[model samples]
Target: MTVYRRGLRFLRARRRAVAALAAWSVVEAGQTFLVGYALARALDEGFLAGRARTGLGWLGVGALAVVVGAYGTRRVYGCVAALVEPLRDQLVRHVVARGVREGDGGALSGLTQQVEIARDTFAGLVMVSRSFLFTAAGALIGLCSLDPLLLLVVAPPLAAGVALFALTLRPLARRQEAFLVADEEIAAHLGGICPALRDITAAGAEALVTADAGARIGVELRAARSLARRGVLRVACLAVGGQLPLVLLLATAPGLLAHGVTPGALVGALAYVTQSLLPALQNLVHGLGTSGSRLEVVLRRLTPDPPPAAAGPAVTRQAAGPTAGGPARPAAQPRPLGVPVCADHPPARGPALSVSALTFAYGPGAVPVIENLDLRVPRGAHLAVVGPSGIGKSTLVALVAGLLEPTSGTIRVLGQPVRGRAAHGRTARGGSARIQPVRGPTACGQRVLIPQEAYVVTGTLAENLGQLRPRPVPEAELRAAAEAVGLGRLMERLGGPAAEVDPRALSAGERQLIALTRAYLSYAPLALLDEATCHLDPEAEERAERAFAARPGGTLVVVAHRISSARRAARVLVLDGRRALLGDHDELVERSPLYRELTGSWSRADSKPALAPRDPDRVDPVAGPGLAGDRRHVVAHGPVGQMQAARDLGDGGTRGREG
Candidate 1:
């Protein structure tokens, strides 16, 4: 309905072009009328009456009408261009406006694909709609001039077929819309799952993931089948409208001849039926059937949603308590110190981390990877999350870090709600201005998350360390954090904190140390480390973990990489595909078989040849552990970056270490 109203409004605005197009179309209609009328005159007054020259002249007149119709069609193309180009431009503007105002992710798809579809469909609909209306008019009028009986024979079937086709339009449009939505949803589902396929297999969720993907694909299949069913009805309309008229006209021919119809008149009527009426009716049925409903659907999709009736461009959506006739809205009150308004309030009595009935999956219609999960960690508590590789340990860390939103349930940090990635200052919404990242001095800046692979930008070492702080970090604080996380050697070697940094030149372990130091310097009350120290030697990993756990009034959640890491935590959470188990390391070692197996594997790994941590202040700057010594480093599915275990020495270049 919106598309229909929009179409009428567009036509009204371009009345001059529409008028010019109609005038030319009338010339085409005259050509159609003359085509059959000239033949009838030729046979009745010239050829059949023994006047051959007059008959040839009548044929020539019909030929001349075709040339005039060609000129009219050329003019019609210009008028159609006038209408179509503006509509396309208007659609492009509407799509961009919606993308900017509403943050619609599908705007690119609309512009690149659907906008062009709408333009082409609208042009075709315009050409077919006008051509059918005037062509039908001319052919029908010519029929009446020939004989009333011929019109009677042809009119009923044509009217009946057009009505039948019209009946199919609404249902066809619904099917088209359904199919498009289903296709997009399935595409998104597949894109999401592809990156997680290895993880899904590791967790033994192959069957569940497969079932979820199948369900999404099934929806698309059903929609396509429904669309095809409507296509069958369109074919039925074609049979009734275009083909049935011929059969009826022939069956009623004998009666027309006996009822005072001449031979030349009979031939003329046949010409009108076969040449004029049939072709026009066929074009109308096929062209309108395919394009008319399609144009409507595209127009509806491209139209922007209407703005609120009472609101204006000047309205400030931030004022919560303002009324229509009340005093002017006041400015936002300043936040108390240590409070990042969009982040948690750090209530004294509440748990630092709270997750209740949380659920998540890779995509829409995907089975929940973390389903109905609940967790809570009190202030100053150290919790270790231990699980097999790819068992959603990182996912839990991401959810707590506000990088991912749970599908269902709540996540509250220090008594404040974090709205996923949007909570981290960048591109997030607040009152009138953009939201800022949560930060504080004692509570651990709102919270810090260090993932497995560290990210270091090209900047001074001091800049990288202070990246998370809301304000500039002091020189003393930077040096203290660097020494605390075992980055003193790297910092001094790279010419102190002021020296330029290239992330690619740093080893994986060195990068991890820098990220740890950055976290150490943040004001977050809680720290989430998702295997953040995995690349480090055991001793260096221990130092980093100990530094975070010792923070003032801070809570720590570490996705553990080794069995020894679990021993330091006050509590351990073990996640397997079937359920979640929680207890202290010693208690779990005694009672849980899975925990024992994991500890046993880690204990075995510890006895194997592993990298020994070098004392930063004592070790030779140019000489350090190389890939030649750490045999157990390749314990997992692939190589574990032994090249980053220490600096690359000349003789130890790319050695194929332990089997």
Candidate 2:
């Protein structure tokens, strides 16, 4: 009902054009009856009485009616354009807005394919429906004028055929919906697997992947076949309803002739049945059955139902600390490291980061990778996240960044919600604000994310770094930022900040450094580095992290790739799939067996066993108070001293890190 009303509203804007079209449709329908009447006159008043001149006059009038009907048909197309183009524009706008809000690329398919189908189908439906109504009315009236009893002979079978065709409508629509679903499934499967083809082949899983894609294709084929079978029933209904009326009229002709039905009137009745009534019914059935079904499917998808709310009250549990049983508890309410607790809510202060009752899965019915997770990071805090490979570390970052939506949960950055499906945020000042799902600064210079691989477009080095800013960055400021993040040498080599350089020519580490410099220059208060420094040397990595953390009111969340990173952070979060353990590096080493195992593994892999050990009681060479305590001393001397400290720890310091 909503879709119908909306479509009607669009049409109403062009009511003058529609009125013109309706007037033409009436003229066109009346011409058909006029032609039949003129022919009947020619036969009865002139040809039957053997008067050549009278018959010729009537035949000329019929030819004139044909010309008028042709003109009306030509004018109707112009009216259709006035109605359909606005509808297309409106649909495009709607699809674009929805796509941006949801971070969905699938809306492109609707804009390109489905929108055209709706436009063309809707126009055809309007034309065919109007023509059918007008033509059927004119044909029935002509039959009654020819012989009052003709209605009794023709109307019953035509009504039965229309009713039967209507009966098949629901089934036909269901098949269409099924076919469309199968087609989208095939497209999504292929799109997902195509980028990973090299990996599938290298892993000797090509055949398995191909088999899965083949199954989706098979489902699409079956759906198409089912839809075709239902379409054949529409053709059958048209024949039974349209052609049967003609057959009945012909069969009863002889009996009618004996009961004072003149040959001229009988011929006119045949013309009304063949030329106007049957053809109009046939067109109506095909138009409504096919186009009407397609329109319904497209509208339903464009305006899908809202997602259901969270199943129960928000699950609050601590994300860290020991339990009563002497083992770390699996969950707990997330409390800020240094904030006064309020009776109803924590006071919004600093660069806030909060996640509550977060859960996510790839598809409905798939096992959740991250479930019921909660965490809070206070303003200006540097927190490192550590987890085993495939334990949902990157997924967690993506959800918080608003690159992907959670099945159910909320992510707040700087106290403003990062928008996603079923997620909403409040501003730091305690007012509601809906943040867009884009990867840039939100309200309050909120956040930015740098992935492992940096993105560099073809432009001057300064342009790439300053892309996040609204205006161009000054040369001196760019140079200082480059020096701070260890990009000074690269900038000098490239012939200053204005030099044009292909991002592809740079090494992975250099690109990461460039990205780090960009993030450093951004006003965003919360910076998420997802192994963004994996390619840089330890000295370069530390310099970049320190530069970002030193920013005013800035908070840092690093998906740590090394134990040293966790040690450098004020706090560390160890996600092991089953649960999360949050605490400072020293406390985590004693309470989290997973954290100790990861550090021990790093020590062995780097051949620096003496630096990091399994026992927490040992004086750890890399993270012990002696070396960790010297961080402030090293930073006080400026970039040169920070670079020197990073170089000393570069090799055999921390290795075999995991995301």
Candidate 3:
């Protein structure tokens, strides 16, 4: 129904062309009727009465009608072009707009593949639908004029065939939609894996990838076969509807003659069945069956719900809370130190981060990973978040970074509320609730997030480092930031910032260090590091953490992978799957069992530390002398560095004994 409405609207926009098409269709239908009438006169008045000249004269008039009909058909094609082109343009504009808003690859497929299908299908549908209507009307009139009894014999069967065909339309459309969905899934799967082929090969996972692709292909194959089965039913309907009427007329001719049906009228009736009714019905079955369904699907996708308002009363409630209405209630009272507060409390002025009653789940029915969580970090605060693997640490960070939408809540950064939907009572409602990525001054230059695995593109070191900046950073600043993160030696070895390097050539630790330096130079007001230093040595990790925290007016939130990172932070948040505990390191060690257990396990695992304990009087090399001898030492300095150092000392002792 939407497609029909939208199509009618489009046709109205080109009213002149549609009007012309309608005029031609009328002319075409009239010509068909005149030809059948002329043939009946030729048979009855000339040939049966033995006047050959008169029969030939009637035949010539029919020939003239055919020429006029040809001209009308030509004009109809022109009108079809006028209508289809503008519709295609409208569809293209809609598809492009959706692609920009959603940034989905499926939109690209729709734009390229589905739009073309809609255009072609719509054009064919217009021509066939117009022809069927006018021709069926003209044929019915001619049958009446020829003999009213002929209508009784042919009309009932004709109507029944058409009704049967109509019944198949919905099922055929459903099958078409299913086929398209299966095809899109295959395309999406292929697109997802193409860029990861190298990693798949390195992991020796070719068989697994092949199996996955094969399964998607199998689904597409089944859908295609189902669609084909539906198409066969359409053909059966066309044959019964269009061809069966002619067979009945021929078989009943002798009985009709005895009942006062003339031979000339019977011949005319044959002409009406063959030339007008049957062909029109055939075109309707083929054109409407396939194209009508495609047009419906395409229109629904092109027209989506309008975006929800950016700010609303619900958003105000989530951000500013009950105080926005009147005086604060008893529920707004501040909790004890390190205890999470409800959203009713006014946030600290100029807070770098604020979260109020946040909750998120992967989908509507899934268990929530974060629930009624509240957090605030003042400007320049250094906070460390720690949790066991899969405790939703990454999910939390992603929500804050605007990579995922929270089911219910509000997040504000640097006093500006991040845009999203607010939770109302117990349930979350659907709206334009997704928070757009922060940008401009509000984003605070990069708002950098360094993940556990660093990203390095194919480019010069300078270009890669300058990714966060709108313009190229000065050479001095680049060098200083690189030296601060211990990438100075690596930079020099690779021939400075201008040198091109393959990201794959660098060790994971080195890549993480480079990412750290990039963040250091970004000068973002807020930085989130999610286990970013897990691949680096303890000393290097400490230096990187200190550099980020030392940035002027910047806030740092690290998803700590080590107890050392937690100890360095002013406040630590320990997530234990079910609940989150927030406190200073010493307080959490005393009060929180999960924190104490984590630190105890860390201490046991790192019984003998390699990187010397923090002491103002002691100075250590950025990298020890044996770093080149064993790369694993550079990766982790606790146990691996000690083993490497002991091996070097053992080699020295053996040489001394030989001397």
Candidate 4:
């Protein structure tokens, strides 16, 4: 009731616009009246009187009335805009203010997606309601003027249909709300667990996870079935409101004519019901049923609740020791193994990459896949982001690269805030860290992102490598970069850097080599690799990554596909969808469960895990495909190498450290 009252007040505030809209609508009602009345007058006084020219003149009047009504319809749309924009702006201000005050994370979703839905649905609902109201008025009046009996035949069914639709409104809205909430819960639950499939598979919890996810899915299925049952009312409304009147008029026709109704009056009354009333009522049932309920739900969520009568005591998680007058500190949380990244630890030069309270989601009702995420990467640091597939590792890189915007919070690559718009922001200028926003393969020209499925152009290899650079790269620098990143062989095979590269002819690994060389030769200080080298062999990938990390005063962030990549990084970020765990490899092994499972999975897959289980006392160094481990020695299971060279790249990543 309160939400409704507030809506009435909003409409009342814009009464002048309402008046202008109604005035135009009245012209439309006049059009409806003329359509029926002109037909009847032409039949009785002209055609039946043998005056064909008079009958044709009356038909011309009805045609002219249609033109006037179209003009009025055009004006109605302008009036609708006058009402809708103000409502949208008002909701935006209120939602923003409340979100800031309450720290409600959903505020961004309301602003971007929900508020837009409200605006469109409100416009549709208004147009249908107004059209039905005035159209019913004009149509009923025309019926009564034709004959009193016509009104009696039509009124009962139309009223019954409207009443039935009105009865479904409250229940239908409740069903909609329930189904939406159920859907959200399912999305949120699946979002957390789906990305951790590697962990789940390694832990042997597949059956349990499936059953739990299935239960949530079943809840949504039931809700949808309930919503569909209610939709049957729409068909019933159409039958009674639009179809039943014709049946009744046809049945009562002979009796009505004997009661003194003229033939022309009968035909005009039928036109009024079918043309004006039936079409208007059908639209009203559909538009109001769907859009009206949606608008109500959206508006209620956007509106602020009344203040509580009294303030409640503040809730806090307290440590054992606290002074009587001082505020309580939060209880100790599980910090990662070394150099805790759970809290901000900026160096004197500030972090090279900083993300504060960053959040993102696919839709308004879907879960926030990344929420309140905070981290800082020091300048020139080698950081690896390791997670199971679909854990939003790529999305995180996209946000940092400024290819996509965060739902809330901020991302700064180097020192400049990342804005995902190329039209407004300029590329980086002046100092290296001073980057501007840009929407391209690179962000502000300070950071370069090498995505999976590398892109190759029809031009020469030199042109492809130099595309990221504003000035053409010298032939010597390009060749040096290619040789360093292990692309020297591919370059030689394809003739030379000057040769035109055919993308179709090149293998997937060859394309990745080209992209890697391109990123290495560019001036961007930060390199983001989102599984960019997946197509390459493990050794080739290692060489490329090391070359990029070894770039002077450069930082590297890799979305790792293997444990070797994670181990090579100085620091690692583990995203399990629920929370972020940041630490070094050995530290994460101790503190993070998801990272432990993921590392196990990647280690086995990356390494040729062809080891035979040996007794704890015996060091089975011979069965190891890549390593010769003694009792006191630990070999880091690393990137694949050939024969004797491979033995040094250990696979025995167990409960001990390397000597």
Q: Clash number for every model?
A: 8, 6, 0, 2
Q: Name the top lDDT candidate.
A: 4
Better of 1 and 2 by TM-score: 1
Report the number of the highest-TM-score candidate: 1
RMSD of each: 12.8, 18.0, 16.4, 22.1
Query: TM-score for every candidate vs. truth?
Result: 0.57, 0.49, 0.51, 0.52
Q: Give stretches of model 1 more than 4 Å off.
A: 97-108, 195-206, 309-533, 536-659
Over 248-341, each residue of candidate 2 has an lDDT whose tens digit, in order, gives 8799989888887777777887888798888888898888887887888787777665677899987877544586768875643322111111
- Show model 3 residue runs off by greater than 4 Å: 11-17, 92-115, 201-215, 307-508, 512-659
Q: What's the ranking of the predictions by TM-score, best on top?
A: 1, 4, 3, 2
lDDT of 3: 0.70
After best superposition, candidate 4 residue 162: deviation in angstroms?
0.5
Instruction: In angstroms, give how far residue 357 of model 2 lies from its true place.
Output: 53
lDDT of each: 0.72, 0.70, 0.70, 0.73
> Tens-digit lDDT track for model 3 on 407-452?
8988877665654312111111000010112224322332456766
lDDT score, candidate 1, position 552: 67
For model 4 the local lDDT of residue 368 reads 82
Question: In candidate 4, what are the lDDT values of residues 251-358, reduced to their tens digit?
Answer: 889998999987777888888888998999989988987777677777888885766765778667644677699977764442211110111212224567999999
* Consecutive 10-residue window with the lowest summed lDDT within model 3: 425-434
Name the lDDT value of residue 328 in candidate 2: 75
